[model samples]
Target: MPAITVSRRQALLGTATVAAAAALSGLPPSRTLARAPFAAAQAPYYYRFAHGKMQATVVSDGILPLGDPSGTFLGTSKEEIGKMLTDNFLSTASVVLEQNILVLNTGDRLVLFDTGMGSSQLFGPTPGKMLANLKAAGIDPKDIDAVVATHAHCDHVWGIMSDDGSRNFPNAQIYISQADFDYWTDEAKLAIKEPAFMNAFIAGARKNLLPNRDRLVFVKDGQEFLPGIQAISAPGHTVGHTIYMITSDGKTLAAIGDLTHHQVLLLEKPRIEFAFDTDPKQSANTRVRILDMLAANRIPLIAYHFPWPGVGHVAKQGDGFRYYPTPLQMVLDQKG
Candidate 1:
C-alpha cells in the first residue's frame, strides 16, 4: 500500500462540510467537522436496526495511533500480517485504531454502549464527538436513559467523563459488568506485574466512576439491560468484557466491545489473540464462539473497533470470518 500523507488543511476542509451541516441544524461544536487539514481520512457514521423499531447508530469518536504489531496476535507471522494489511489497502505494520460508540434507541429509551475517549490529548481534535454525533442524530445526552460499558478500558470508559471530570451524560444511569468493575478497582489487580498500565486504568476508573458510584449499576451476565438488550458475558479481554445482544422485530445485533482489536487479523485468524487481551487463550475462545454464533445466526454486529460506522455482518469464509460493512451511504440513500 502506498503511504498517504493527508495535509492538515485538506483534512479540515474535508470535515468542514459536515461541521457546517451540523451548525445549520443547531448541533454542538464538537461534532463540527475538524478544520484541520486532512492528516488522515475520516470515516462516516452509520445507522441500522435490529428487530424493527430499535435503531442502532454507529458514531465514530476518532482514531488512535497505530503502534507496532509485533507479538500482538498469536502465531501471527510479520510477513503474513503485512500481506493481509496490504490486501485491505492498509500499510503493513501500521494499524489504525478506530474507536466506535453505539447508540441504541429502543422507543421508550435511548442507550449508548461504550463511550469513546473524551477530549483527551491522546485523541487530538477529533476526540469527544459522541455527544455531537448524538445531537446530529437528534438525540440529547439528557434523553439517554442508560450508558452501558463493555469493560473499563480507557478508550471504552474514558468518554463517560468530560474533560472537566463530570459525567457527560447527566441523566443516564451507567451500567457495567460486576466482574469488570471489581477487576479494575481491586488494588491487588491494579498491582499486577504490569503495574503501570493497571495504575493508569485504576486512575481512569476513579476519575470516571468513583464519584458517580450511586448512579452506577453493576450488571450480571445474562441480565437484561433493556427490553431487547441482553448482557452476554464473554470475559478474557478484561475480567468482564461483554457482548450485548439486541434482539428486536426479527433481527439481532451484537454490540461486542473490544472482543478483538483488529478485524482482519483477529477475524480472519480467530485463534490469534492480541497482547492487550488479559487471557489470550480465553479471549480467542470467546472470539471463536462469537464468530461462530454470528455466522450461524446470520446476525449483524456493531464492533467498537472494526472500521468506522462499525456496523457489519460477519460471514464464515472457509475456516475464518469476513466482515461485510453495512455501508452508510447505501443505508442513507434508501432512507431518503
Candidate 2:
C-alpha cells in the first residue's frame, strides 16, 4: 500500500480547526466533578519533623510587616537595599518577616525558643498568632518546660506575657541573656531617647520581664541550660542577642534567633546593618563571624525571622553568604 502522510500545512490547519471548534462550543461540563465552595483560609501554619532524637515543630506566630525597607535595614544605600531585594524576587516597598517559633520535644521536656509578639501592636496585627499555632500543633502552652529567648527585642520577647503582665508560659522557666534582660528592662533606657521607638521597646521589656524576674535564668554563653540545648552569645543585633545550638543524638541544629533578619538582605550583604541593632557595626561583625563558622562547618540553622519554618544551610558567596532553605520534611525521614 502507498504511504499516506499529512503535510505540515494540513496538520496546522487541522489543529486550528479543532481548537476553533472547541472554543466556539464554550466551557465543558463534567458529569461527575464535585462543586465546592472556595476555602478562604489556609491550613495550620505548623511543620513537624524528627530531628535525630528530638521532635521539632516550627510554628508561626504570624507575619511581621516591617514598614519600608529603608527605615528598617540601614548602613547601606536605600538604592542598594531595594536592588538586593528586587534581585532576590522580594518586596522592595516593605519588609514582611515571618516568625518561625521553634519548639523542641526532647524525650524529657518541651522547650520553646523565642515567643512571638504576644499582644504587641508594635508592628500591627499580623503577629501574635503563636499561641493559636501552638494549639494547632497540639502543644499545650502550660506544658512548655522551658522558654528560651534569643533576645529581648519586641518581636522576640513581647509575646512572653499579656498586657496585664500575665505569664504566657506560666509553668515554664525562662532563659534569656542577663545583658538583654538588664538592658531592655532598665528604666534608664527611657532617658536616652533618640529613636522614638525606643520608648515602646523599653516599656514592653519592663512590662514583661519585671514580673518574671524569679523564673528568669540569665543564659550563660556555652552553657547547657536545657537538655541538648546550649547558648552561644551573638551580640550587637541587640546588646545580648544569642544563638542556640540544639544537639540530639549525634546531630545538631542552630536556632539563630535574630542573627540575620532578612535572608537575602543580610546574607547577601553581611555588613548591611539593621536599624534596630543596639550597635549596628558590632551586629554586622558578629553576623559575619557566626555565618562564617556555620558555612565552613556546613551546619544547618533555623533563622527566627526568615521564611516560616526557616530551616536551612548557608554557603560563602561573594563578600557575604547565601542561604539555602531545606525542603520541609513532611513525613518521618527514617534512614534505611
Candidate 3:
C-alpha cells in the first residue's frame, strides 16, 4: 500500500466545495449523500489482489428506492420498524436498494459476479451500467470468460442478455446453482403463484434461461467455482439461494445476496423474518447462524442490498449483531 497521493486529496477537496454550494442553494445534490463528495473523489472503484495473480474490483451501477411496505419484515410492527431505521440513522419511510456487480481478473480469465439490472428496468435509464463501469476500470465485457449467478433473480440474471435478447457477454459461459435452476424452471410451481410480481420473476427466469440451456452450467454447494472462490449453501431467502466466498492471502470475503433486505433490522432482530423470504423461519435461522459466524471470525461480508461499496464486518452487540462498514482505507487495501 502506498501513501495517499496529494493530487487525490486535492481533487477530493475541490469536489467537496461544489457539493457545499449545492447544499447551500437548497438544490438536490447530483450524487448520493451516503458517499459524500470527498469519498466520490476516490474513484468509484475498489480493488484487492487475490490468488497471487488475480485482482477484483467492485463497481456500482446505481441504487433503487424501496418504498415503505407495511409488512416488509414479517411479524414486526411498523412503529417498531420505524425506530430501527432511526437508530441506524436511516430514513424510516424509504430504503435504498443498491445494485453492485463485481469484476474478477484472474490474470488469464475475466469473470463477473452478476450482470445487474438491464437497461430497460424502472430503476434508471441506464440500468445495465456494468459494461460502462467495467470500461472505467479498464475491462472489456467481451473479454469476460464467465458470468456466475448467485441465483436466478431478475436483477441478478437479466443482464445476461441485452435489450434485444442478444447475449451481452457473447463469449462467456454462464453458471448458476443447480438447485436454483430446478426450482425456477418448474412450470407447475409458476402456476401456483397468483401475484403478478412473482409471476414476472418466473417468466423472466424461464425466458432468460431456456435459450441458454446448453451454455448454463449447474454448480453444487461447497464446490470451487474458480481457483479461490467456493460456493456456500445459504438458502431460505429463496430455494437454493447461495453465497460465494473468495479467499486470498489469508483473507476471505462473503458475497451474500438478498439475505437481508435492510441490514439494520435484519441484523439486530434475526429472529424476525421478512415477508419476502420464501421460508420465513428458515431464513431467520440462516440469518442468525451466518451473523454469528461472521462476528465470531471477524470476517468481512458484502450484501447486494447494503449501502454502496457494501463491504463490512459484523460484530455481536447484545443478543444480535451490528454491521460496521469497512473503513475506506481497509476497503482500499483488502485482497479480494
Q: Tell me the whole-model lDDT of each prediction, alpha carbons only.
A: 0.78, 0.89, 0.75
Clashing pairs in 3: none
TM-score of each: 0.81, 0.89, 0.80
Report the lDDT of model 3 for residue 91: 89
Could you give me the TM-score of model 3 versus the true structure?
Answer: 0.80
Q: Is candidate 1 or candidate 2 better by lDDT?
A: 2
In terms of TM-score, the best-performing candidate is 2
lDDT of 1 by residue, 166-285 (tens): 778899899998788877767655566573466777777767877778898888788886788899999888888988998877667888888878778888888876877878889889
Where does candidate 2 stray beyond 4 Å? 1-35
lDDT of 2 by residue, 1-336 (tens): 223345766788887777776667773432244799999999889998888889899999999999899998888899999899999898888899999999999989999998988877778878999999999999999999999999998888888897765788999899999999989989988876788888988988888888888899988999998888999999998988999999998888999988999899999999988889999999999999999999999889999999877999999999999999988676777541
Q: Candidate 3 on 1-336: residue-level lDDT in tens?
A: 234677788789988988898889887768555754554344554344343355667776667665674546667788888888887788877667777677777667787887777664645464566667777877777898988887887778877887677888888888888888887776776776554457767767776777788899877889997877888888888788888887766677787777766678888887777766777888888888877887898888777777767778888988888889875544444543
Q: Show model 1 residue runs off by greater than 4 Å.
A: 1-51, 122-126, 189-196, 329-336
Candidate closest to the true structure, highest lDDT: 2
Candidate 2 residue 91 Cα shift, in angstroms, is 1.4
Model 2 TM-score is 0.89
Task: For model 1, give the 10-residue run with minimal summed lDDT.
Answer: 327-336
